[model samples]
Target: MRELKILAVVVSLTLLTYYLVEPFAHSKMHPHVDAPNYNFPQADKVTDAENVEKAKVALEEAEKAGKEKAIKSAKTDLANAEKFEKDTNAFWASAKAAIADKGNVANGEVLVTSNCTACHSIESKGFPPVMDNASAAAAYGVVPPDLGTAGKLYTKDYLVGFIMNPARASKVTHKFVDGRVHPMPGFDWMQPQELADIVAYLESIAPKTMTDKEVFHNACQRCHSIKYGDMQKGTMQAFTPDANIKTYMGKVPPDLSQYIKSRGAKYIHEFVNDPQKHLEGTAMPRVGLTQASEKQVVGYLEKVGDSKKAQREELGPKFLIYLVIFAIFAWLWKSKQWREMH
Candidate 1:
């Protein structure tokens, strides 16, 4: 039918626009980034890459000119740099092997309690952070998550690198230049065994089974409150008051209630894994969540925002069929009228 032909053209164009044009536009807007690299192989990939070699050469030249101390320092620097690169590249695999071989859960607990509890909480032990969000924001410029699910929700390797170096783990080491200081500078100085021990402790505290909602709350609720996400309209709030978050962060973080629908899964995953990649200088810190945790967070976001996604998809084809059927009936009626005119 002529009507059907026009409708087909309209539908084809719509599908092409949605499936092809929109995706092409988005790809240009946000260039593709590989999945988060827990190993952080090139943690200082951007900033410290050239500097290390340059510094060593300069130090070597100084040593040649009769500065005995400079030669020794250059060798030390070169060795240290080489060791750090090797360790960082191999950190994830090494951490897993260490944890299995010699991870001491008890010693890890002691280490985390003494060193990590000041900023983080271990809900299983009922240890709240020593400092509240306002004070924490003043210190770190953003709120931090509780370590309640860090063990299970984060990959073992991510936990290791994150503990060893926060900025490196988050891919934001450049922001810490000129002694600017990250709120939580990781204990990179810790021995490999020591880092493994702390990870072992965190793994011990995680719940064996967690619902998607629990994953979201532990990972996200501290800094981002959901929109109308509470029992009442005004019930939900970030751990820190908006004023303190805004004073340093420059803007209130957007409500994530509808972001799953707006930003879509691909964008949300990349953004959450590394905020700096999406929004340069965004105050949102990479929380170092495991892929499973990221999936659960996205799942919960979908549940809250696009609860009808599955239903809509199921009904879409049926609705299109009904439209076509109606179009056919109208076309039939119009043909009968044309016969009368003839």
Candidate 2:
């Protein structure tokens, strides 16, 4: 009876430990958010007539002050504003023209392989063309993402805009803590028809049904590895040499083997969508994955972290019932033994 009581106490303590530690681990992994919430400037607002008036006023003020630098800056701003107005009008015209043409997927595939495959991989198999992420990180600050899932992950309109002008599509300008800016260069050189074809090719190659596992493989596996039993999905090659780590990220990235258990699904979703939003100066840039893909990645993480979670939950009530019956029998046996003694 005493041994059984001790066993029950141990089990109760173990359950308590899990409950307490789980919450604490989650809290540490996902503290209160501190990063700035950036609102991207709309294209319409960028070329608004009011901005032209403001720039004109600033130009006059700077000229009156006789400040060459200020005057030059104001003039530059005014010129840019006017140019954007013109460009916006042209973009709409091109969009209308492109909408009528259903693009050639074959031509787009060729274009992607020729131009894009230099930095991004369309094929899911084998090492990517830009295999050296360390060197790529040194040059571009962040390793470029694989284009395997791009078609399914982004809308046609967004893909078109991003292909035309990456910087404009992603309006937020990310500045690193080391005073370096990491901006994606625009590809305004690609013609509208060419851009349309590339989008079509991407759509052609996109997975019809992207499982959660595929999401993790395509998006997270480049920098992270998941260990399921003895099987490993990706390599954990050093992002860069230790000497250059400070220049890039300031610290080595953590293994995400148990990230879901430690951080929780909500934390994973927010972090995956925008890492900088959770941790300022994090090396993990926003990969621009769709909300669905992000959720799928989180789901994959949860599965990896606790493969038997469903089974555990299903057995919980039955286990509790057994414990109750055992306790009653234990009490009854003890009572009977004491009664005999009396």
On lDDT, the candidate that comes out on top is 1
Ten contiguous residues with the weakest lDDT in model 2: 34-43
Give the 10-residue window scoring lowest on summed lDDT in candidate 1: 39-48
Question: lDDT per residue, candidate 1, 1-342, as tens digits?
Answer: 787799899989999999999989988988776565443344335323444676678776977787788777887877766665555455444444543545699999889989988778776798987687788767766777788788988877667877766766665655677877667766767777888888888888889989998888787776677865544445346776677677645677777888998899988988887786678667676767777888899998888888889999999999999988998899889999999999
- Tell me how far candidate 1 lies from the true structure as C-alpha RMSD in angstroms: 8.5
- What TM-score would candidate 2 get against the native? 0.58
Model 2 misplaced stretches (Cα beyond 4 Å): 1-107, 110-114, 124-138, 154-172, 176-179, 188-197, 209-213, 227-246, 334-342
lDDT of 2: 0.66
Q: Which prediction has the highest TM-score against the true structure?
A: 1
Candidate 1 lDDT (Cα, whole model)? 0.75
